[model samples]
Target chain A: MILDLIQNSFDGLAMGASYALLAVGFTLVFGVLRRVNLSYGPAIMFGCYAATWVSFSFHSNIFLLLGIAVLGSVLAGTYVERLCFAPHHKGSAIAAMVASFALWMQFEEVVTLVMPKHLYDFPPMFDAEPLAIGPLSLRAEALVMLACALAICFALHRMLYRSRFGLALRAVTDAPVAAQLAGINVPRVLLLVFLLASAIGGLAGWLIVSTHTQVTPMLGMWSTLKGLLAMMIGGLGSLPGAVIGGLALGVLEAHSQWFLGPQARDLIAYLLLFVLLAWRPRWMTTSHG
Target chain B: MTALLEVRDLVTAYGKIEALKGVNLDVQQGSITCLLGPNGAGKTTLMMTIAGILRPRIGSIRFAGEEIAGRPPHAIVAGGAALVPENRLVFPNMTVLDNLHAGAYQRKDDFASDIERLFTRFPRLKERSTQLAGTLSGGEQQMLAVARALMSRPKLLLMDEPSLGLAPLVVEEIFRIITQLHQDGVSIFLVEQNAHMALKVAQHFYLMEQGKVTFSGTPGALAEDEVIRRAYLGSARA
Candidate 1:
């Protein structure tokens, strides 16, 4: 029982790390643009499919696959910004959100038509062998996923807090008009934000496919919803909050599945979300400026 | 002195309501030009228009002999023009140091020495360089706003109501900084409500009412007019 509990917690942490990446992407875009990119789900889905295509046609090297996925995500992100977000950015937030939703549906339809298959098996790039440490058995891939996620998070934190681009981004985030007066190009910063968020979303998608060893069209919607929920729980627009929220969500889902059953996992997670929303509506408010 | 900035027949509006009607003004090189107007006289609008935050419906603004009427705000700053915006709208969430850095966002050269110079000018900002601008006092925020604009190394600095909503001591400090900047060879275009303070530093003055320049003269000319003096310089001074 003790060993099973340890193993479940470890599994939960690995899953949580992936969720954290997605949530960070969601929060970062929302923070800068002040609008939710509903197409983020489709963007992640596109990344997974792109990585799959590259792996099958050429090589199955993990680093190369991840690179392809990031590149795909960046492209998709730029497309959404140009087509769905930028023109309407100065308009109502609802308009941008609605446009993103439309793009999301378009992406879903495109994927359905192109792939035709309901599910595709992702090629394994990491050893699936379990590593035992002091009676707690953990998969090597899961460990690698956790390490990768944490490393990405660290890198993002440093980029935001320590770099010149980061300072410009934060300046834009704080007061866009003031940023303009200060000689910062607000539009360029906004585009950079969308690209960064999309790249992170792609990384999360790659991790999810690598761990589950499968890809599906449905994964896009699922990941987006989970990421949004995690962002809300962590406090929207707060980076540290998103991380904690994602980890908390993963742990909660794992414990729920273990205690109740696999079927109750999503149900319990949503219920917790509902409770959090009810208890702290103010906490969920986005405070960008 | 050659005009550093020349504005001719500038018209700006907000949804059919004209705020500036065929306005004409000029800022001479190395001199302080003040625009004095009552509330709703479109002072802020003129400053914003020059800063490229607002597009004039019809006008030509020549700066350093180059026409720059419809350029974007960043381009205007790159052309060596900067606005110390009204209400001291500093990046509230950013550190004082970061705010200073952002002021020089367009410059490719190293700005470390410029920051040090600003620190020497406003010593209080240097002490709280790492603190967020939002956490600073109103006086400090205003100082940061001025310091931030200075970081661009602008040849022409436009100031709009730098003394608004500040204590008497703070207001004095702001005017002192204005005088110091003018002495340092930076041409200034100033919009101010305080006509008494305007008389101290302004080499040329324009009075606007109902979106038109109603009066233009030196401080002596303004002082000689009883109606203008009482209306603008305050009852105590008049």
Candidate 2:
């Protein structure tokens, strides 16, 4: 039982890495804009679908597919930003969120119209066998996901703490008027942050699809639900909180699925979210220190 | 040489009600000029318009012998003028050092020396460089706000009510800094309610009432005017 628990934890961490990336993207947009983008999952799905379409049309390198996914996500995200967030920046945040949701529905319909099929095959990131050590096995793709998540986290930390752009972003987040007086272009910084978040979403999408070796429309809602869940579980607008929340969620899900079954796994996840939201943990309220 | 800032026929309105009705003012080069006004006397509106944070309905603002009206706030800051905003709207979550960095966002050159110089000017800021701006006392936050504006190395500093909501002793310290900055050759356009303090530091003063310039003259003229002295300068002062 102990070994099974450890093995499940390893698998859970690998899955959680993708969730962490998605949560990071969500946290970025939320922190800077102070508005939620309901269509985050749809944007990633749009990117993944674009890559899948390209793969179906012509055999391409996996790296190229990753690039296409990222590009497609950024394109879709820009559209959402321009159409939804930017227009309502001065008007109402509620209007912006509603518009984003409308766009989310639009993305789903557009993807469905373009691809007619319910599911499609995707190229796996790694064709290697699972490595076995001391009666434990780990997938090579899982290891890659874990490494990418950690490296990206480190890079993001460095950027936020050590760069001029990061300082401007934080200033804008703290107070937009003060930021403008400081000569930091507020709108441009917001757009850049949105683009960054979308790019990260694209990466998360690519990681998840390639690992599963399948693409489906449901992936959009799945990614959104998981990302939002992870973000809430971690904290409102904190990067590190998003990461820890994502990883913890993944482990919880994995263990529940192993013990109580798939339905119970989801039930427990939702229940945990409900409890966390009700209790309103202190860590969930504060952003970065 | 012309005044550092020249405002001609400036009219700014909010919706239907006009806040500034054809206002005219000037800050001479290398002089600390002050604008004295009560609440809702269009002082903040004028400061915001000069800093390019508000769009005037009709006006011409000539800064350093060039027209600069309806330009964005960032452009104004880059054009060698900065506004130390009212209420010291410092970024509350940012550390003091980071707030200074944000102020110097537009500069490409090395600002390390500027930081050192500001630290020398405001030693309390340097002592609490790592502390967040929100945790500071009202006086320290005002100092941080002033220091932040100076980080842009502005040639003309527009300060709006620097002495607002501070203790009498801290208010004197703030006035001392203003005098020191004026001595260092920085032209200032200040909006103030404290007439006595303004009388001491202001080379020229303008009294604004209900969005119009009611009085404009030297400190001697301000004291001699019976209407102005009884209404604003307090009954205890001559």
Candidate 3:
């Protein structure tokens, strides 16, 4: 029983790490543009498929695959931002959301047309062997996922707090007019924000595909929904909150699957979200830039 | 002295209503100019028009002898003019130090010395260097706004209601800073409702009412007008 519990917790941590990346990406875009990029899910799927192609064609190392995926995702995100978000940025948030949703549907259709198969097996980057320490056996991929997540979070924190570009981003996020007065190019900052967030989302996609060993068109929507849920649970604009919320959601989902069976996993996870939000509406409040 | 900024027949409108109707003014180089008026007198609209935050419907804004009307705000800043916007709209989520750095966003030079210079001028900002600007007191926020505009190393500084909502002591401190900045060769274009304070530091003053410049003269010339003095400078001074 204890071994099963340990295994479940490890699985939760791996899933949480990926969710953290997705949630942070979503929150970063929201913080700057003040609108949801519904196309974010498809962007991640694009990264995953791009990585799959690189792996199949070149048998490239993990670093090369990640690089291609990130680049591809950044390009996709930039296109989405230019076509769907930029023109409607100063307009209604609902309009931007609707536009992005349409973009997302178009992206899914393209993915389906390109790869009609329901699921394609992704090439594994590491051995699936469990690394055992005493009685606690954890998958090596899980540990790697956790480590990568933590590293990305630390890098993101440093970029936001210690770099000049980060300073401009935070300023623009807080007040665009004030940022303009300070001589920061508001449109350029917005573009950089979309690129950064999309790159992070791509990294999350690569990590997810590595663990699951399968790439499915439905993964895009599912990953986006889970990431959005994690962001909402963590609070909208806070990066640390997204990480915490992602991990918490992952743990809860894992435990729910264990107790109520896998079929009840999403149902229980969403119910918890509803209850938490109802109990503390202020939990949605974001404190930091 | 030659005029550093010249506005001629400037007209700015919001939708159907004109806020600045054929207003003309000149800011002389190396001198402090003040614009005085009551609320809705188009003072802010004129300032915004000059700063390129608002597009003038009809007029030419000449800065340093070059026509700069209808330029974007950042381009205006790059052309050596900065505006300390009304209400001290400092980035609240940013730390004091970050806010100062943001002020020098267009600058590619080593701004360490400039930041150090500002710290010496506003010691309170140094004390709360890591604190968020939103958490600052009203007086400190005002100081920050002024310091931020100065970061652009602008030759002409346009101030809008620098002492809007502050303690008497803080208001005095703002005036002192204004005087010091002028002494250091920064030409100022001040907008204020405080006739008492405007009369003290300004070399030239213009009164705007109902979208027009109704009066233009020195402080002594302004004091001579009984109706203007009573309406603006209070009855005791009149």
Question: Of the candidates shown, which would achieve the greatest TM-score relative to the real structure?
Answer: 2
Model 3 residue B135 lDDT score: 100
Candidate number that wins on lDDT, 2 or 3: 2
**What does candidate 1's lDDT look like per residue over A36-140, in tens digits?**
988998988988888887877898888898898889888988999998888875678998888888988887887788788898888775765687788888887
DockQ of 1: 0.69
Ranking by DockQ: 2, 3, 1
**Candidate 2 local lDDT, A1-289, one digit each (tens):** 9999999999999999999999999999998888999999999999999999999898768999999999999999999999999877667899998998998899889989999899999999888889998889999988989998999899998998899889988998888888989998888888999999999999999999999999999988899999999999998888889999899988999999999999888899899999998998889776653
Give the CA lDDT, 0 to 100, for residue B236 in model 2. 40
Instruction: Output the TM-score of candidate 2.
Output: 0.94
- Here the TM-score of candidate 1's chain B is 0.95
In the range B49-111, model 1's lDDT, one tens digit per residue, is: 999988999989999999999998899999999999999999999899999999988889999
Task: Output the lDDT of residue A71, model 1.
Answer: 91
| Best-fitting candidate, scored by DockQ | 2
TM-score of each: 0.94, 0.94, 0.92
TM-scores of chain A in all candidate models? 0.95, 0.98, 0.95
Docking quality tier of model 2: medium
Would you list the clashing residue pairs of candidate 1?
none
Q: Model 3 over residues A163-247: C-alpha lDDT tens digits? A: 8899888998898788888878777889899999999999888888877888998877987898899888898888888998899
- Candidate 3's TM-score: 0.92
Q: Runs in model 3 with CA error above 4 Å?
A: A54-61, A281-283, B9-11, B55-58, B222-238
Q: DockQ (Cα-based) per candidate?
A: 0.69, 0.75, 0.70
